[model samples]
Target: MKEKLARNINIYRKEKGLTQEELAQILGVSFQAVSKWENAQTMPDIALLPQLSRTLEVSIDKLLGYASQDRPITIYEEAYLTQDYYWGTEPNQACYQVLQRMPPTKPIKLLDIGCGEGKDAVFFARNGYEVTAFDVSDAGIEKTKRLADQIGVHVNVFKADILDYRLDQQFDVIFSSGVLHYIKPEFRQEIFDNYKQFTNPNGIHFLNVFVNKPFIAPPPEKEPNAYKWHSGELLAHYQDWFIQESSEIVFDCNSSGIPHKHAMTSLIAQKMTSLDH
Candidate 1:
């Protein structure tokens, strides 16, 4: 495993056109450490694996010499199996606001990542938008299909992981709420970059992430399913985009029926038209 990881690190770093020194600088490690890793003399710390894989644009499984397959299916499957509407049946407030402001003349293309039970996807579809919704859970996709059927709305639903899902078409609006935080911090930037590239000119992205806060309690040690973003992290990533709205708020977990305080950063930004393009 060590030798395989060493070879992969070398291959991926070279593929990115980064030298040992460059990769070390990006990872905030010494060049010698990078050299040692590639030489198979040592391995990166467990915590550094996520960042390393992200920098290489590879999955953790692939970086660790495991066969690249579907991401672990247990997490979302458990959620769907245990709860019908894990996040409730209504569109979130952020999504609802975006839907209300959508243009009426043209049919807008919308993609809902982590669509969960499909409430938001169906809501947009019913509102006359062409919607494509996807989740990692089979049950979630089925629930989405059922919801669309019940509402007499059409939504193209599929099962996919956000990390590896390929986007063949651009969208006018991309909505992802309470989902980005679940991604490893290193991979979040790649996801954001993909969303930006997949958005049409002047297209908007509605995103929200859990942010670190003093008052917010950490997820239980045994259930570390999500990562808390640093304050202003989302803004830092989208600094060049046209920010339509941005805010930080603390709210109770009404959807989960859990009386816990949650700190979140919500943002709506539009891709800017490039003059060179």
Candidate 2:
């Protein structure tokens, strides 16, 4: 939460054209104090939260890194409330790629982004990887925890929005499936940069994004914020990274009880600082 607060303060302050000194002056605190907050070294006083929120033009909840208590952002919330898992109890096939490549021979920290129902997150945990997972839905988080408990493995799962959640710790493997479209195009670079920065050296990221295709029609779910990626768009952002594998495929889906086809681009990228690995 401290990391979220710091990131939000910096982002909102910049959006409002305020520097550290200016924001400090408005909050009646030292510029050093404002800098400290943005650096995640310290936090603002509780009394100043309202004022800070007002000045930033964002709610206190947002400043503290909480998604707004507004309407449901994800349709799966209701579906997940059912007795069965919405997506299914099976881990994605991409999970096997990570397991085979990294093998968890040593302690490997893995993060399952948008871990719907905990299938993949629990899979990683059961494979001896320290796993953390998050999704935007409360029901999904509950299901994730329940699945992990039923499997006798622990997954540190919580609720998080991909747009607002920033990693404060490093991970060896970062995996996400069918969630990158939630990120607006303009914010993609910044978000990916943060993810890359927080990754350990030689860390791997396996991600798949729904791509816009001339032949393939859109899915049944009309999520409000989803923006389909252009073919190879995900790779353009990782030109500097070692692209271990990449492929584009068209697959059938029965989500929402409506059969449809989706074109997706999947990439396995590795971070490297030097040629000698």
Candidate 3:
């Protein structure tokens, strides 16, 4: 396992165009320490794995040399297959409200992460935003493509896992709804880092993450899915950004036709523009 991790670290670092010295600088360690790890002479402390993987833009599972194909995909695939509109057909009210507030003359480039069935992507496309949407589930991407076609709107939809997804271009608005919590606790920060890096200056991020609350039921032992954030934990991640709106609310979820209370942290924040500009 140590050997595999060493090789993976080397590979991912090069993939990100980072030298050993550069990686060390980012991690606040000496270049020799980075070299020792890659050489398999030593292993990074367990606590550094999250930060290390985040800096490399890879998942902890991938950094440890687990088979990429072994990552969980079926649960989401089944969810999209079993339900016509799993979350709902209508776009979230917050999404609509944000779009209405955008300047009319500026062209918005939007990226919708975990865009199931293309509801919000299509809505944005129809509203004149250049939209790119992706989901880990192939079924979800296909459904999104079909919906976009049916609506006579163009949306670049694809299947991608957020943990390993590369951000080739920046976006004017990056929206993620009820998706961040689906990632394991360790990887959520890495995903957020990617979002911040790929968003254009002054761009807005609209996100909602599940949070633990007294009223919410405990996670099922058998399923073992979705990480719950502690109160105010999610907000702390966006402290440097210009917060436009934030709220924690408990609501009844009827998506599965089984009503259950859910706690979520919803936020809308804008990236800061360069002071020099």
| Candidate No. with top TM-score | 2
Q: What is the RMSD, in Å, between candidate 2 and the native fold over all Cα?
A: 3.2
Which of the two, 1 or 2, has more TM-score?
2
**CA error at residue 20 for candidate 3, angstroms:** 12
Alpha-carbon error at 64 in model 2, in Å? 0.7
Candidate with the greatest lDDT versus the true structure: 2
* lDDT of each residue in 1-277, candidate 2, tens digit only: 8888988898889878899999999999999999999999999999999999999998898788887556577878788999898788988999999999888999999999999889999999999999999999888999999998999999999888887888889999999999999887767888999899999999999999999988877787879979779988999989999999999999898887899999999999999976765
The model with the greater TM-score, 1 or 3, is 3
Model 1 TM-score?
A: 0.72
The sequence of per-residue lDDT tens digits that candidate 1 reaches over residues 153-217 is 99999876664454667999999877776666666676678778888998898888888898778
Model 1 misplaced regions, further than 4 Å: 1-76, 219-222, 254-257
Predictions: Cα RMSD each: 8.2, 3.2, 8.0
Name the lDDT of candidate 1.
0.80
Summed backbone clashes in each candidate are 0, 0, 0
Models 1 onward score TM values of 0.72, 0.85, 0.73
The C-alpha stretches of model 2 lying farther than 4 A from their native spots are 1-3, 10-58, 275-277
